[model samples]
Target: MNVLIIGGGGFIGSRLATEWLRQHPESKGKITLVDQAFLDIIKNNPGFECIAGDFSDPSLIDPLLEKKPELIFHLAAVVSGEAEKNFDLGMRVNLYGSQHLLEKCRQLAYCPKVVFASSCGIFGGDVNQVLTEETAPKPKSSYGTQKAMVDLLMNDFSRRGFVDARCLRLPTITVRPGKPNAATSSFLSSIIREPLNGKATSYPVAPSSPFWILSPKQVVRNFIHAAKLSAKDIGDDRTINLPGITVSVQEMIDSLEKVTHKGITDHISYEPDAFLQSIVLTWPPNFDTKKADALGFTADKNTTEIITNYIQEEHIQVPEK
Candidate 1:
């Protein structure tokens, strides 16, 4: 089972590569890790091959299609903030780039199973208190709009028997390691992750601001589960919302306090940024993932568990007294 991860060098993508390699070492198949950066980070791992190229390049798709990987996980994207900032780049990479891949798959005589990593931002607005697979998407950001559009295309392609595709609407993955990126929600992970590591963090949203979240570990598991799911199980929709736990900014701070045992909570101060607030306020706070649950997809049982597991797995050292 040859697997190709389009953005394999990224946080969630890299984790998925590692997990798949660890679990399927004996399987006679190659795992190709493709990303424009972080090739060296994944180079040392056995059974791993790296392809450094831009997914937006039309030329890149032909070579990848020639490889004929049996499984493809399309995770490459410009992310939320960058997408909103660079509209043309966002459309080129997030929307058209995905279409390029799907077109290649459609041209193939033997189609592969494609697992697209979509975002919950597609739901949009605070009024929709609980999002479900049935909810009509109303994306507010270019990034969200692009993901939602690709999701519809995936369904249409699947119905046409071009490929076995499943779109997983991932929540805001929190407690991510490493320095922050362009995502507006990066602060959600940074506030807890950075402070726990004895670093300062800023809260860009109000303490009462609430949003749905999933840990990196849960996100990886959800991706693998999506890949393993049968097309018959997914039906004609071909998209499902992954489960997540919803909590407020204050709740996250309190959880950090409990785990770190330091009044690190004091290190956090709310100074709401209108730009980020506008984007965040439009995101759904919670979801009704009954369909996902029934389909055997799951997230962290609780927010506390999500935080603790991240601290443990990433080996982020606790602050000293």
Candidate 2:
């Protein structure tokens, strides 16, 4: 079975690519990674083909469609903060680009199974109760709005028999390796990974701030599980919130203190940025993932396990202070 991973060079996308190859080694088809950069990273591996270009370009997608992958995992998007800042770019890349891909699948004689990586940000604004699949989405950020819109498109297209589409609404992925970027939630990973490596990190939200988080491994697992789920089982909903651990900022810091021998808690300083705080505060802190659980998707055991697993997976060296 062939697979095409859009935005395959990215953090979660790259990890998903590796997981796919590891799980499907006996398969004959190549795993085509479509991205603008980092093609060199996976280009050499057997059954891996790196195509470097913008998916936003209509001309670029035809060749990809011609290849006729059996499965398409769309994880490409301008993230939360950047999307809110540049609405046009977010619409072009996140909304328009996704619509174009879905349309292409509709045109195909044999539509591929599409796994869309959506965000929990789609369920924005204040809510004391846990969010379930039935909760009506009220997105506060442009990024969230775009994701929700595409989610609807996925459902509509699935109902029309255009494609076997499944949307997994992922939570904020924590303990991510590498340098920080424009994503407002970057600090969630930085606060853990950077300080563990003896580098300073910032927390742009208050200590009491609560949000849902999942490990990189769990995120990849969700992608794989979604791909394997039968269309008959997934049904008309077409979208499901992947399970995650919900914790406050203070709880995260407490986990850091317990995991690392050294006093890494001191390394973190909270100076809330209104823009970042505003976007984050609007997001749901927890989800009622009963549907996801019943469907066989899993979450981390707890925050400590999540942190420890990340440290081990990333091979982050603990500092001697």
State the displacement of the C-alpha of residue 156, model 2, in Å, after optimal TM-score superposition. 0.5
Off by over 4 Å in 1: 27-29, 126-128
For lDDT, the strongest prediction is 2
**265-316 per-residue lDDT for model 1 (tens digits):** 6677777788887787899887889889999988887778878898899877
TM-score of 1: 0.97
Question: What is the TM-score of candidate 2?
Answer: 0.97
lDDT of each: 0.86, 0.88
lDDT of 1 at 286: 78
Model 2 alpha-carbon drift over 4 Å, by segment? none
